[model samples]
Target chain A: MRHSDQDLRTLMRAAQGGDRAAYRAALAALADWLGGYFARRIAPAQVDDLVQETLLSVHRKRSSYDPDRPFFPWVAAIARYRWIDALRARARRPETSLEAEPPVASPEEPVLARLSLDQLIGHLPAPQARAITLTKVEGRSVAETARLTGQSESAVKVNVHRGLRKLAALVESE
Target chain B: MTERLDMMIDDLAAELAPQPAVRERDGRRAALAAALVTIALVIGLLGLRPQLVNGVADALVLVTTALFALLALAAGLSAIRMAQPAVGAPRGGALWLFVAMLLFPAIALVEHLVGRPADAQAQIGLMCLLNGVGASLFTAAVIVRHLRRGAPVLPEAAGLCTGLAAGAVGAVAITLECGGSSFAHLAFFHVGIVAAWALIGRLVLARLVRW
Candidate 1:
């Protein structure tokens, strides 16, 4: 999930130079990368087949890799080309792809969430800011914030709207 | 999926054969050599047209042959580059060659209307067209086979380049052997190689270069 470009390139170079261990490691890293790549677009069962196909393709075209250029684009191009071929073949025999279940994002790459609510909310006018921070950032319901802050439910909604607009403008201008 | 891919990689690693240390530029050199040999064989077997000796003295004949020679070089280089996708897209040299070949005749036709020596006669001969087609198919098949072993990503572009490479050779053959100076004859007989291949390259390579 966190392989660096230099590390991958070194592994590939060693692999190209006939180091079996390096080759195995490179393939391992690539398989991990491709799992996340395909999982986002395809069913779980389909990911393995595409990964296998892409690995085989990359191995075949290893000689074409230019040492001067970055490796990921060349590798990704082969994967995309192989995927198109698979799509074309599957289209001709439609029964193969139908058996797979629902698609899902890759479990290997956990999605991270980061919100800077305090900074954004601080940019709003004081009353509107308080309403937004209490409802959105502090996880309070509008009715709860209205009762706590002595504002009507409709007034809380209007303040929250104004707060969101200011936050969006500040973020956009930056 | 991870387990299956790991097993697949192990199989691949176990069977991994050492690839030849060929540089990207080497493909271009190899393709050009192949093209030259094909052109040579075609010329030797078919024999140059008897008019070539006298025809070379003519300005249009020199111009036409020179144009096709450039086409041949461009198409050959493009085909080789296309074999290695990382190098970039195949050059548009073949397309330019085609446009020039088509444009030259129209210019000649206009000149004929103006009483200049356009020599725009129409000679319909299936023999040269058939010969050009045969040579083009043969040359293209061989080069494409070699390129396919390299696992070209853009089979269609590679196929078009293959056709152009073969067409370049066929164009040379037609230019060397055809005695006709007619605009229609040269367009239909000589330049037809590029046109035919450009049309069929996509369909043919889809099957031939399948992943």
Candidate 2:
């Protein structure tokens, strides 16, 4: 979040030119950002997997990015396609539910999820993180968090439980 | 999680596949060039039918030839556009053909309404239509194979456009090669090929283009 969009663009362009460290940093930032982005829209349990796929999709589609254009949209385009693909895939097999939780990263995904609080906060699903950030981290009431996030109070409460459960699962896995 | 994400980033970088830059090739140019070359060869080999001039008045022959040529060109451009992963439907570009399409059917209907009973003449050798389709298919197949690499996001649209391009070539060849100018024959065989290609694009070829 400290880097300007211009800085991100420069980082991506360097990555395109085969700067490995720059590329890694850009992807790390993107993966972290995607965690926040997806947290709001989907269940907390689904966030990590989406982040990994979006990272790969961005890597695969890097060819399509025009450096002159804004960076996020290019990344967002890949994210959108992957999201749609995931939706179609989920639709084909709707028996899966959030409560069941997902298995850890698949072979196709890079193993991710060592979390420092900043990076952990970075990696949490958007809604869960937002719910946590508002109601727990910032000490807002559940109703105020719900009002800010446009979530029902029950949904807000559920997100807090689920977000905490996600952290606990990471600890249990560790 | 910090160390894991750090290691993952490093590993991802090490394994990262840097994609080659995308250069938007002119699919339209490739398709049209292929079509024009193939149609030229078809005409040279099979010869334009002598009956074409006598079957229709000079103005109508000129008009019909122009119409078929334009249709072929339009379809060629569309096929190329649709083949690109980024470009999807032909959108507004495909509407022009409907004018020619409607005119053919409307003329046939009005002729029948005016008491000229459907004048379907003797079935001439439709050998050229088939050959034209085959030849254009070969050319289109070669060019489209590369276009497919660009990633056909709308596989159905891409396939339809590719098929329509080939069909246009076939239609043009038939225009010059068929002896019968009967409204029924031109409508059924000439224009019908494009429709067939569209269906093939939607049903058959789309699957082949997918990643």
Candidate 3:
């Protein structure tokens, strides 16, 4: 069964109290979320290591985690930082390949895509940006994202529905 | 292709988690080393010569012990409070404690110098000077730990260095008053204590503080 935000909060408290079971459960749940988040940006072979690094960092800094905040966002922030660190490490490595695909979409694409999406997604609300990131960027199923995110499946579905419609409308207008 | 995007997201997720084994192994090693050091120091202190123990000629030891015990209790409480999620700026409190611990020994030295009776007081003063030197070394260890953790090192280091200098001066004063011409003992022991404290501080700081 999916745990609610309140449920995750309880688990966080238990983990802070040094409950191994609660820590394990929390790690297991966050791992999937983090896995999907990193899988998009790093090589398949490196993703596992990155996920492990993020999880370990989270565990080490667990005492710093505020129970009042939703767990997934905090986990997501950690994942984001790990992603940035990985990118920096990769940048420092000597480039051996004769040809390498540019690390990301052309800078122009980000500017255009973000700007186009911002007008639309920005208008929908914060929930829509979060929902789209989970569904589109992270590729979590609506039910799973809802469970991890502590939103009701119906609430998640609505956010996804509105987000996608807004994106489609923005693209159509352009 | 959409499949590529799916694969990429999956790959990134797996890359972010740290290896559980590495974390566990490092934590275990650190905890074990700290415990071992504590045990070794306690054993070594207990093995000191009877003369050295007997030479502590006044009630100063009792007073110093009481003072340190209270300080240690306060430090322990601060550590616990800093560990809480709600505590903002843990570094601030940690820094303050470091400074206080460093200055504590110097304060004791001043109190000993200013208050003790002139004749027997010289012996007491000498003992207090030695004790202050020991405490200064301990405080240096605490400061080094803070530095290793990537915390600000300047203020704590300043406090410790100042205390060490004050302790050396106190030792010299006691030696002069006691009609002891041996600057060697004062210089060697006082400076040696500071160096030892710095070394131990580096080791403990490296072990405990997360970089």
Candidate 4:
């Protein structure tokens, strides 16, 4: 659902003046907008958490919003601030890094492959990179690659096929 | 998740009461008033410099006092605006004013190194430092209170501006009462107080303002 800036502003103005219905509508509209906003910037799994946090911030800092101003810009600023905070917090977390995933291929795989191999693999998600490296690059049997990467043999084949397709797409675009 | 969000919205709406929108001008006005009151109290306790009363305060004294007043006004307004954050809000000219205010300390350091006859009065200097810091407390409280009432995106920047603004207020309050004309005194006691407050704002006030 989309809300016009004017509609949001009017609702916000009334909300500031203690109109409960207007306040609820305004917040609901804001929550929807915040969902879309964060979905564009972060992973799907993280979007809901950021949306909730931004809404909480809006509720606490409602007084900071001026009735004369456009409501979206003010709300957008709060969302951006929360997004930055989330990004900083995520950066500080060591367990979330791509390197934390299972190392299926040998450490010397990068040296033997083309210089762009690591950079291309870096573009893929961790699972895709691990699957493609083990089954395709290392020429390991599908059953062995699955066992090493802790995936089912079928899942391993799917990831390698998807990863190669994405690599091809990336190379063509470049 | 949708159900959770709906519940949250209901809860927030239920708790809603009439809330006045935070105005940047109001925060600035409150901080300015607090600074003015502190200045008056400090001046009342320790009378104006003799030269100022005689209408013959030197060029350096007049200039330094004026700089402090300007810095207080600039940084004070900037701090208030930061509390009411907006996307792409242009940071005001407080940064330039702060840079301008540093000239005094640079001059003081040069003078000290050149070995000019020391105009040292350990007791008076220490008293001015304490009084300068004391005068800033109220102004900083007013600004920080305003910050708590709103949402500041860059809390560290807000805190630094708060310190600069409050320190400048203290410097303005004590400048009229101080008779010290030496660069070292102005640098150490006046500008030093502002620097100390800015550091405190960055380290201490950031945590207070963080959401």
Q: Name the top DockQ candidate.
A: 4
Q: What is the lDDT of candidate 3?
A: 0.45
Ranking by DockQ: 4, 1, 2, 3
For residues A1-174, what per-residue lDDT tens digits would candidate 3 score against the true structure?
455667777777777666666666666666666655665555444556787777676765664455765666555655655655564454233121212423443454334534544565666678877876676545577777788778887787777766666654443222
TM-score of each model's B chain?
A: 0.79, 0.74, 0.34, 0.92
Residue A123 miss distance in model 3 (angstroms) = 32
lDDT of 3 by residue, B79-118 (tens): 3222222212233333353345445445545555788412
TM-score of candidate 4's A chain against the true A chain: 0.56
Give me the runs in candidate 1 sitting further than 4 Å from their true place.
Answer: A1-6, A43-45, A66-69, A93-100, A103-174, B49-52, B87-93, B104-124
Q: Which prediction has the highest TM-score against the true structure?
A: 4
Off by over 4 Å in 4: A97-174, B116-123
TM-scores, each model vs. reference:
0.69, 0.63, 0.34, 0.78
Q: Candidate 4, which CAPRI tier?
A: acceptable
Residue-level lDDT tens digits of model 4 in A1-174: 688999998998999999999999999999888876765554455667789899999988999998888888788888878876775554343123333334424443334343445677789999989986665556577788788999988787677767766765553333
Q: What local lDDT does model 1 show for residue B116?
A: 71
For model 1, what share of native contacts is present? Answer: 0.33
Q: Which regions of candidate 2 fall more than 4 Å away from where they truly are? A: A2-44, A61-77, A94-174, B1-12, B15-20, B49-79, B82-92, B95-117, B125-129
In model 3, the runs with Cα more than 4 Å from the true position are A1-5, A9-49, A56-174, B1-67, B77-91, B104-205, B208-211
**Chain A agreement with the truth for model 2, given as TM-score:** 0.56
